[model samples]
Target chain A: MFFIGWLVIIKNQKGKSWIKLVESKEIIEIFFHGRGGQTAITASQLLAEMAYEKGFIDTIAIPIIGAERRGAPIMAFTKISEKKQIRTYDSVKEPDYMIIFDTSLLDIPRIKDTIKEGVIIIANSPIPIDTTDFPDNVKIYIVDATGICIKREFMHSSGPILNIPMLGAFGKVTGYYDLEIMEKVLKKEFGEKKVEKNMIVATDAYESVKEV
Target chain B: MSKARKDFTQEQETKIIKGNVSAAYAAKSARVQVIGAYPITPQTTVVEKLSEFVDSGSMPGTQYIKVESEHSAMASMVGASMTGTRTFTATSGQGLFYMNEMLHWATGTRLPIVTAIASRGPAPPWNIWADFTDVISQRDTGWMCSFCATHQEIYDEILMSYKVCEDYEILLPKFVAYGGFILSHTSKPVIIEDQEAVDNYLPPLPDEKGWPHIFMDPERPMMFGNLIMPSGFYSEFRLKIHDAHMKAKEKIKNAAKEFEKSFGRNYGNGLTQQYKMNDAEVGMLIYGDLALQMEEAVDLVREEGYKVGMVKLRYFRPFPVEDIINIAKSVKVLGVMDRATAFGSPTGGPVSSEVKTAIEGVEKTAKILPMIGGLGGREVTLEQQTEQLKILIKMNETGDAPGDLFHGTLWHGKLEVE
Candidate 1:
């Protein structure tokens, strides 16, 4: 009877194999929470472009548009798929990954609630964060992206451009992309003059990012 | 007006680009000679990209006119078209609404000028998200309207738009619209075809003689849009425009066939494309970006032992009536989804109302479920779409409609009010 029950379980799993494959090969949806002018929205687009350049079959970067101010909260979503086309254009509700460009965004209830079980987070912070409030299934990684940007002198008129470093840390943790792919896409997007400096900060963040 | 054709041996390149940029690339590839520009959200980047191309001398000899308003943009396109050049421009939402006056002027003059529209919701509170009402509202403007579901289709359809619109037998302005931000802002890999192959496919730019009817030549200047008496061919001109639109249905199909032969890409009859509909008992008719996602929903629902299919309505003005009738006959129940509002119209949604009219006199047809969602860029997730499919199946099985049917239409995804 135990063997028959085991067989039944296996049969059910077999019947639902397509769902499993879909989940496995599913588009990786990543949510970004940041302050305006921190470049989180651009990060979302850069990540998609980099993933596509790295040979992912499809990618879409969506920015949630609203009234904008210099330091107001902003949100964006990037989805990258390996084989199947990413069709739905909805904002990611249950993201596989999250990038917090400003760790203070975690204090906002709406941003905090976006955190769910089984999500890997790569946050830009100079110090470790208190993850006790998060579910146990969630993993947290941190990189001093802002510090790296300062160190590498990657800044615009407002402040440090955080997208490259955040993307760098993301690449290091998830292995979705790498420094090489980063250089290639950045050079193409930002042109040759800025690529070297951008890669400097990106490389620093990639090497220094660590689990919290 | 035949010129020496360029070589066609160069390979096509695929680039990860936004839908707006894809439209710009299509205009560049089609070698559009005149570009009228006005900045609007989502659509601004399209003209920006073109201006850059022109500034860099990549599009040599092309004239870029920076217009102050969308009205002037369309007016400039009409003026340029009268001068015998391939003309193109793009606009969205309020910009499209502003151009309403000139839209009639282009089609009335029978100029084959092509325009891309990044469709957005009309506003009282204001919105910049994906909605189709802005384009659908122009249905009576005598222009051929089509929607694209993917980035590559945005490029391919514009190329095909010029091919169909420029045909002497069907000289009509066409609007190739896609959902704002949903398509306009999203990035995807799209193949930019070889220019030589495109040139070979599209008709050569008209010579100085201009279109068959009108031209702006110093040697023999002609007048256009002059007043005509009520008894003097005014009614006849209107009838001819109607006649050309009816005839364009065939020209569009032939253009799609020839495009496929040259580019090796198929767009399912150029009117409507179907997915898994051969033995479907329940189906949905959708267009624009939503149609692509609906395919995924159909796939998921089919996995659960349900017979579901999807038909993507490509051309709106040429209203794929025969295709809708045929699909209606195949399904027990059909859901027509629209992302645009029709206010107090028969169905409260644009495409659904059209679907009802198309199947009105059919001998055997599915019961139509008029549905609306994703207005103003409301996120219609795949799960919601799966539920939508299940609702269709339930309606088929139980012979009952879904709840929240306002005036016999299901307004899905409404927020609860306390």
Candidate 2:
């Protein structure tokens, strides 16, 4: 039973406890932008599982599905809350964080325009992004998630499996979870055989990710 | 910490799973004997995962059937159901439309078949996205159609549907519907109950004796579903289907109550669940994925010190007329929101029209603001839902209607094509 053990905030009202819990703190919304083959959607889900495993009261992973081809740009969002149930399934607009799987996605206007003031950006790039057009006071962390995946031999059929390392970098950047939490979730999702390789790439990005 | 171990027989497992996966797990938990499947967008993964479960020998007791089309998929389910086995299948949008005739065949034969619907918009702009037009279009088919507001509810409701649908008093087919991509594709934390807990909650799987309703054995051979003339039991049978739907309301509520007692999840009497409606003067009646968001919308609206509430319409076929009427009477104004369209209907939205019909002659009824939006997987934000509640409050304060009322219904969130 997910969150059944977490009955810390019990509201004995005529309305009930779930609604009362959902009305607590503002939810932490993270948006992920990636091309179709890149596994941004899985990154979103994995991030949710990791956060929830690390004791976030509630979380949801929403992927915007479309007629996507291999190279077509796709989007997903993960909303995790510290003390509240995530009732809304809407895609994040004014996101607290953005995970960019490719640097070239910023060239697309729709993706670029969502970079709001004071938002933190974690992009999978080997170098600092051109931030001449980025909003003021925005924090950006750059990780060579692709580079780490290749070095660790985390090659899926399409390319490097980007989500595992990307989420590993995310855990380090946000401090919402750690490599241990990622290990627990990855072992659960990918199982023991696949978890070793996945964690190898994950630890690479976890140790190497830095603010630009 | 080791919660996601491969073994599933003992302890309950909680995992972040797609809604389609939840439905598939529900079928596995229910010990469904047969699956008739045809792949469609948004619904493909459900049958795909069920096939995986069957192929991997995890569900060795189950039989998986791959059919060419949605019609054959349901036709196979009807045939399987006749043999008195717990049968399941899933389809969406055009696939549901293709299975229309068999949908009636499943219900009219009084089979306890359960189908998961990743509801999508009807085709011809050739759309395959979230919309309830497909399931609601099966209104006359006599299947008990229910909507799920959360990912967990998709699993809970399917298990509950079996209890209600398999009841001798209401041996009817059912559709557990949710928004296609909005729910079906999205992943969320869902609690997968252990086999022991599920078996304890649900009725025992029919023994080798087959289902008692229509047990087909070589020793006890009997013909079923023979053609009936106009003067025959045709009219009686039709009346009995309607009678069972009316009775299903109570059975659904009981199942929800027992589920809460057994599994500790509350679904507000199963037909319609309410949030903060007791002290509210205005409320919103909604269903499917949007209703979960509206709870947040209601909480946000309540933070501003306005009396607002919400009700998620859980079951559509039973209609839950008494509950709808009670909700209407308790509020000063009620907004009926629909994520599916109903062209030429009185309210221009399916559920809103039903709400109107439900309270037609009710005394001192609340003003109903009929609304339709979020169709074809359109994004209806929390702010938009909060705005709709504000519109209802304003409608209560001042007797003026909002602008751009097509046939006196609000067609909200349409793009401005200048």
Candidate 3:
């Protein structure tokens, strides 16, 4: 009887997997806390562009946050899916992901306003995220992209443009996209040599990330 | 209707293209689908001309969105570009400063939208003069930044920026145009490439196919950016964006090259342009409209017994750190001039800061000096520059550097106190 029940469970799992391949679609709202020059908006654009190219027509909206200079913290949003038109212009009321470009922003009070239950937070720093005020359901991920860039011989040690590797890790966790599509999107978005190096970095990041 | 015959056989050819206006015309000619902007000096003509075209039905299926502010202008284009439309906007000086918040957003989203800027001096009493500070300040915004020196180049590069930006190899949008006071006021002839020619140059717009399509799904809904435990998430994505821009630099260069090869005219910046620099011991580094003055000064200095060169910085946003370092290695004394000042600092200009950063470890006898000149439209004469160069060359020889503040309008006379 136990064997028979086990076989039934396996059959159900297979059916669900097949159904997910055909019927699954989503509208995810991501909130990013970054300053001017950071890749908060570009992150969403890459996702939207890739989704659009893959026949998943999505819409993205980023509210103008502040008239601040470089290194000043700002906020932006994105929405993606494969359904009807997305017309709502509201800021992400409850973001599913809260990505902070600068970990130094933790020193600023009320930086946690973007956090919510089940919200995943990603930061571009070597230090672990300071989530003392965050909810128990909130998860945090941190990597020092500035360090990665320097190691890879990119530009001024100035920290910006870390979305490529983070997206790779994000894709691996969610299983939302295959590496092939992401690489293609990166190539289309960035170009060849960069795409090649970044793809290696991204794939390595994906491999390095430990699923929580 | 009967028309009286007039002398229609006059072969006429003279279409003035102001830098900003030319950029707008180029964008329109490139079949931009949406124009989002707010009026600002120097850059106001860009949208005004675009409005005229849309109003006159010269361009169809193009939405001319008038926003309340520069911030909204950028935000609107961010939305419009997501819809797979070619989007553009323009601003100048404080307007670009105001849109600073959205600049990163536009680039972060990797939207290949193009923007024309009429660079002007920034705030504190609000002066409208051509300066690189506004554009130089946002060099970290992740946009493919390029400057146009002439009105014709503005038209060509505006189109070129879009072409390079929208290339599948380079998805980030770009900022291109000269200063308003210089290029906007100075009218010159520009070759308006036929629409057919432009269409042939740029790739067809993004289409729905095997590429990821954007849509709203309700039933099988999933989250876009959901909470993921950092078993490692943050560092990875940031690298992706950085990688894209670094990769895009070469792609942009290649696209510009290809555009030149196709059109038989290369208005795009060939990496960094060096004028009479190969044999020069002293060089002046300048950007935007001020570079023209530097070039003229170099010419005048060359006539004398001075081996002087001028480096015109076109792509300022990427900072071009490596290239600047390489150039700094050769020149004995590098005099960096900017029309903008960073209050209370050794390096009063952004260009100086980049040069200093790039040459941190260079083992050379080169001396770099940053000078703030021509702010608020104060004249920067060749004589004044020559005098400055004499001092810089002497400083390089004797190792006796001048004080941080070289020249400025004195608000106070020599105080009559002991």
**Model 1 misplacement above 4 A:** A1-25, B1-11, B208-210
Q: Candidate 3 chain B — worst ten consecutive residues by lDDT sum?
A: B1-10
Q: Which pairs clash inside model 1?
A: none
User: What lDDT would each prediction earn against the true structure?
Assistant: 0.88, 0.88, 0.66
By DockQ rank, best first, the candidates go 2, 1, 3
True contacts kept of each: 0.56, 0.75, 0.00
Candidate 2 chain B weakest ten by summed lDDT: B1-10
Candidate 2 chain A: 10-residue stretch with minimal lDDT:
A6-15
DockQ for all models: 0.39, 0.40, 0.01
The top-ranked prediction according to DockQ is 2
- Can you tell me the DockQ of model 1? 0.39
> Model 1 over residues B152-263: C-alpha lDDT tens digits?
9999999999999988888899999999988898887899998778878976766654464756776876789999998799999999999999899899899999999999
TM-score of chain B of each: 0.97, 0.96, 0.85
Clashes of each: 0, 0, 55
lDDT of 3 by residue, B1-418 (tens): 0011121111222243446667877877677888996998767878999998889777766789989999999988887876667888988888888888888877666678788888777777676766667776777787778887666667777777777777665578788857655566444345677665676786557553311332113443433334657776656655766777777668667867887886677633455678888998887777666665566556645655678887877776556676688678878888877666665554666667667887888787367776666665554544455455555666667776664344421111122346
CAPRI-style class, candidate 1? acceptable
Q: In model 3, which regions exceed 4 Å deviation?
A: A1-212, B1-14, B210-232, B266-269, B343-346, B395-399, B402-418
Q: Which residue runs does candidate 2 get wrong by more than 4 Å? A: A1-25, B1-10, B205-213
Best by lDDT: 2
